[model samples]
Target: MRELIVTNEPVLISYAEALLKDQRIEAMVFDRNMSLMEGSIGAFPRRLVVSDDEWAEAAQILRDAGLGEWVVGNARK
Candidate 1:
């Protein structure tokens, strides 16, 4: 899997996940439990990831949704 976005905002992650799901791309948020365990202090930022094979398409989907700023820089290939 590859990392797509890393953020402390759960709402953003949820929105991104929904967008991906609408396109049939499965996304997983990592470190969510860790972040909660850390008291949601924004310390352990959560990561949204998709399978390596779906990274490019998922990134493009997010970018086209006006969330390009949140997409990871090294998303290519």
Candidate 2:
């Protein structure tokens, strides 16, 4: 699992999660408690997850859906 961003906003998180879900890409968000904590540059909501064995396909799905900005590390084909 890897973190792609740190946002305390629920709406954004939900949007991303739903998009991933519709594509049959299983994912999980962590640092939910950080939402309540004051994000002081470091403390922030972390969405932690991987694309299973279907990462390549999922990456394209995400790109087509306008989430290409979130791809982390070398998500190679």
Candidate 3:
């Protein structure tokens, strides 16, 4: 799996998930429960991840949605 985006903003993650879903791509949000460990201080950014096979498509969908700024890692592969 590869990370599509990582951010402290919950809304951005939600938006990215929605966009990916709209394109028939399934995404997994990691560290969502980290809030419990971090005392809900938004210190740990949630990670949106997808399979390596789906990374390109998922990255394109997010970038098209104007979320390119939040994307992480080398999506080109």
Candidate 4:
């Protein structure tokens, strides 16, 4: 899987997941347990990832939904 977005905001993660799901893209949330174990201190941000082949489409779906700024690395632009 390729990491797409990393953030401490749970709402944003959920929103992004929903958007991707609507487009028939599968997304996985990583580090959710770690973040919870840390008591949501924001130290361990959750990661949204997709299969390597789906990464580009997933990123574009997020970008088109006004979440371009949240896409990881050069994918944000």
In order of appearance, the predictions have TM-scores of 0.90, 0.62, 0.91, 0.90
Q: Which residue pairs in model 2 clash with each other? A: none
lDDT of 4: 0.89
Indicate the residue-level lDDT of 44 in model 2. 60
lDDT for model 3, on a 0 to 1 scale? 0.87
Which has the greatest lDDT? Answer: 1
TM-score between model 4 and native = 0.90
Candidates in descending TM-score order: 3, 4, 1, 2
**Could you give candidate 1's per-residue lDDT for residues 1-77 as a string of tens digits?**
99999998889999999999999999999998995577767888899999999999999999889898899894544
C-alpha lDDT of all candidate models, in order: 0.91, 0.63, 0.87, 0.89
| Superposition error at 14 for model 1 (Å) | 0.3
Q: Give the alpha carbon lDDT tens digit for every residue of 1-77 in model 2.
A: 55543455677667777877897777788876664576445456566465456666656666676766665543545
RMSD of each: 1.9, 3.4, 1.6, 1.6
Q: Which stretches of candidate 3 lie over 4 Å from their true place?
A: 74-77
Could you tell me how far off, in angstroms, the CA of residue 5 lies in candidate 3 after the best superposition? 0.3
lDDT tens digits, residues 1-77, model 4?
Answer: 99999998999999999999999999999998895588767898899999999998888888889898898874544
As for candidate 1, its clashing pairs are none
Candidate 3, poorest ten consecutive residues by summed lDDT: 68-77
Candidates sorted by lDDT, descending order?
Answer: 1, 4, 3, 2
Model 3 C-alpha lDDT per residue in residues 1-77, reported as the tens digit of each score: 89888899999999888898988899999999999998999999899999999988888777777777777864544
